[model samples]
Target: MIFYFSGTGNSAWVARQLAEGQNEELLSIAVEIDKNKEYKLREGEKVGFVFPVYAWGPPEIVLRFIRRLKMIKPEYLFFVCTCGDDTGRTAQLFSSAVARKGWRCAAGYSVTMPNTYVSLPGFDVDDEDVETQKVHNAVARVRFINEEIVSRVQTKHYNCHEGALPFTKSYFLRPFFNTFLMSPKPFHATEACIACKKCEKACPVNNIKVTDRPVWGDNCTQCLACYHICPVHAVEYGKVTAKKGQYKGRLLRDL
Candidate 1:
């Protein structure tokens, strides 16, 4: 089984491709979290976790879900992280977290996808051509990962960088990110909002409430779902996002 958490469909696309290629069951972490039940992996089963990199590490929601998960001894375990630039030490961090639960990580992989974090300065969504290329490359990489998983290849570690700086950056930035970047204080719906409540529904954490417009709660993953999935493009993360391009990996019709 492959459990995945996606904010704006980048990791979702990767998870779907991997599941289709490997003939494995695909599970949504968001859905599971909503179910509010512990998940138990079957004995001797192959398991995988797929998610996007958040501040060089796993998102807060993903971490919480993994900690609460109950699983038996799986024959193989792996993780795949999707990122716009590099995954930093996201895989290693996840491995360490799961190790505390007595599960050994067999392999880790990273796939570069379109940049969807448009809130940051100097960062915008990639162009259509670039996103297309990224999707093509990601599909190929997922296929290779599927082959390795079938062979049960045990990769001890994996990272976007070969040096130690990525590790240092990830370790230091993760705490800061958890403290500041994950908050929903900066989010506000614009005048274009139709009070559709799509943002509230799209929020995986259920942190959004729609009244006259939409009110953001403190529990936010900074998943970009509210911004990217908004039909009227009314959700804005401060003034910077007004000029930033929006991307959700797939068209609204496709979604």
Candidate 2:
């Protein structure tokens, strides 16, 4: 089975492609977290995780889910992470985290998708041409990842888009981002909000409740789903996203 978490549908698209390629079942990590159940793997069954990268690492929700997940010992295990730019040591960090749960990550891969992180300076959605090219390239890359997983390839480092100064980005900058910047306090809907309830339904963690406007809780994944999926572009993160572009990915019909 493949456990996945996505915001803006980038990781969801990747997860779906991988699931089809491997002929495996798909489980949303957000939904599974509340199930509070245990699972047993058949002999030689492979486990997989698919999610998006956040702050140069795995999403906070993904890490927390790993801690709460209850599963028997896994045989071959792997992961696929989606990113807008590059994943700086994200897979390594995630592997270390999952190792505590008695699961060894045998392989890890990354796919670059359209940028969705707009709650920061100099960050915005990719250009239309760039976005199109990324989706096309990801199709071919996911096929390669599927072939590697099918062969049970084992590796140490993440076979992903490791950009320059990975250690500095992942180790130094990531903690700072996680410690002080990741929060839901900055999110609010402007007057343009039509109370469509799109933000409430788009929230992966169910942290939003719609009254006249959407109310955010403490358990946000910072996935920006509410921001990007807003029909009238009503969701704003402080003031950083007002002029920024938003991207909500569409899935390919076939991998």
Best by lDDT: 2
Candidate 1 weakest ten by summed lDDT: 156-165
* Cα error of candidate 1 at position 227, Å: 0.4
lDDT of 1 by residue, 41-63 (tens): 66566888899988888887888
Superposed Cα deviation of residue 62, candidate 2 (Å): 0.9
Candidate 2 residue-wise lDDT, 112-195, digit = tens: 988899988889999989988998999889989999999999986769998989889999999999888888999999999999
TM-score of each: 0.91, 0.96
Error of 2 at 143 (Å): 0.5
Q: Quickly count the clashes in candidate 2.
A: 0
Report, for every candidate in turn, its global Cα lDDT versus the true structure: 0.82, 0.89
Candidate 2 Cα deviation (angstroms), residue 86: 1.0
